[model samples]
Target chain A: MKWKEKDAAMYLAEKEYVDTAVIPLMPVTAGKDMQDVVKSGEFIRYFTEYLERQYAGRVYLFPAFTYIKTKQVPEEQLKHWQELLREEGFNHFLFITSDASWRRTSADSFGELFWIPAFSVENMEVQELAKTMEQQVQQLVPLMMDMWQSEEK
Target chain B: MSEKNHRVSRRQFLTYTLTGVGGFMAAGMLAPMVRMALDPALEASGGAEFVSVGLSEDDLSEEPQRVDFNVEIVDGWYTSEQSRSAWVFLYEGEILALSPTCTHLGCTVNFGTNEEYPDQFFCPCHFGRFERDGTNIPGTPPTRPLDVYDVEVRDGMIYLGQINQRG
Candidate 1:
């Protein structure tokens, strides 16, 4: 399920089924050369959507948490968001992003942080973009499964 | 003389009025029955339309191969194409096409992924495993067997239809 209105309504009625929440930690840079940051945001959206489609009933794909990369990392804001979702019965929180800087600042306070190196998606062909997305999905699946199994234990 | 000729008989007027009202009442009573009789003809048939997954008989072996195809969905006013996948293999001279979606949590299952179970379908989401025939292993998260799709072989191509839950 997604964070949209229709899916949220269904999630409320069947809250017991959805235990995992996926949040995309998107970095939005202001002023100087914002092109790469925007591209990373696009990639994160595509990857998260693929994850949601694979595990629709069990995972809730939340809206992206946009934070300024050039400025201070909004750790407190993310912690607050995590607490809110936890109260709403989300046990597993997976934060996916292409921003590497998050690895330095994020303390795993919210949940598991999956950071992949950002790449230039500009001027890429459709087939090439799909191939790259497939590769990323293949890599992330094992990591996601490990987290889920550890939580069960 | 003009008044007498112009005046209609009471019997004739009553017969005409009764026929008109009774015919309308009879037609109203039969309308719903007629609609019910024609309803099945208007609806799409129960037989599902098969879609080619680009897999041939020669490609199928003892091992399952993942085949993806697009299925057109018409939901009211919105029409869109959605990609669906299945695991196809040949067993005992018969073709079996199983849905890849896990029965436990709807995650896509991989074939021969787990080292412990070399020939079973493994779901990474909850560690669910299915036997070679798509039956859920005992003590696994999945309660039922993986769904199987209706398969048809036309000419030299393999076609798949709606997925049916195991009985």
Candidate 2:
């Protein structure tokens, strides 16, 4: 479910079924790397949107957690969000990002971090971009399934 | 005296012809604009069209296989291509296609994914289970059976249409 008003109401009603929260971690930086930062953010946004549609039944897609790369510490800020989501009863926390630095954060009790290399989709055709993202998301599906399978034991 | 009244004066003739031409011009400009405004409502409310799922009918077996396909959905003025999946297999010597969406909470169900429910569709989100024929097993979360898709085969390829809800 998305963070829309209608989906929010639906989430409240079916809170038990939707136990997973997927958050996108986006880095905002301004400098010589502004273009690259924007590109990566765009890629992550598209990737998460596609991912949400596939697993919308059981996952709540939260808005992107944006933090300035140079001005703030992501770990502290991200923990605050995770704590609030945990309080809301999310069983699994999946953080998806193109920022590799997130891997340094120590794993939380219930949260899992996925750091994928940012694919710069600067000049691709629409059809090609969709096909590429679909294939990439397919590879992540198994990893997510494993996450759920591990919890069963 | 009667002929003089019947003959049209130049001023009267110009007034009549100009009014007639002006009405035609106004209608000509308004017709397309009106049609454009009503284009959405005027469109045919057709049934769901069959989309090729890129699967061969010959490959289907008794074991249900997940086939991912794309559908073009138009909502209001926005049109998008969405990826959807269905379980396709041979049932009773005929091709059968079933939607994998769990009826209870809309989770995607997998075929034979759970060890306990081998040969049945299993919902990972909650423990919803459906038999091989898409029947929702009693005591499962899903209240209704899995939806069946209208299947079409042409030139050895399989195409699936809109889902038909089952009681």
Ten contiguous residues minimizing lDDT sum, candidate 1 chain A:
A124-133
List, residue by residue over A70-115, the lDDT tens digit for candidate 1.
6567777888889999998998888888877677775376698888
**Candidate 1 — what's its lDDT?**
0.83
Error of 2 at B136 (Å): 1.3
What TM-score against the true fold does each predicted structure earn?
A: 0.74, 0.76
Q: Write candidate 2's Cα lDDT for B18-121 as tens digits.
A: 99999999999999999999998988664689999888877889999988777888977999877778999999999989998888877778899899879899
TM-score winner: 2
Error of 1 at B92 (Å): 2.8
Among the numbered candidates, top lDDT falls to 2
Q: Candidate 1: list runs displaced more than 4 Å.
A: A4-18, A28-38, A68-70, A107-109, A118-131, B1-48, B74-78
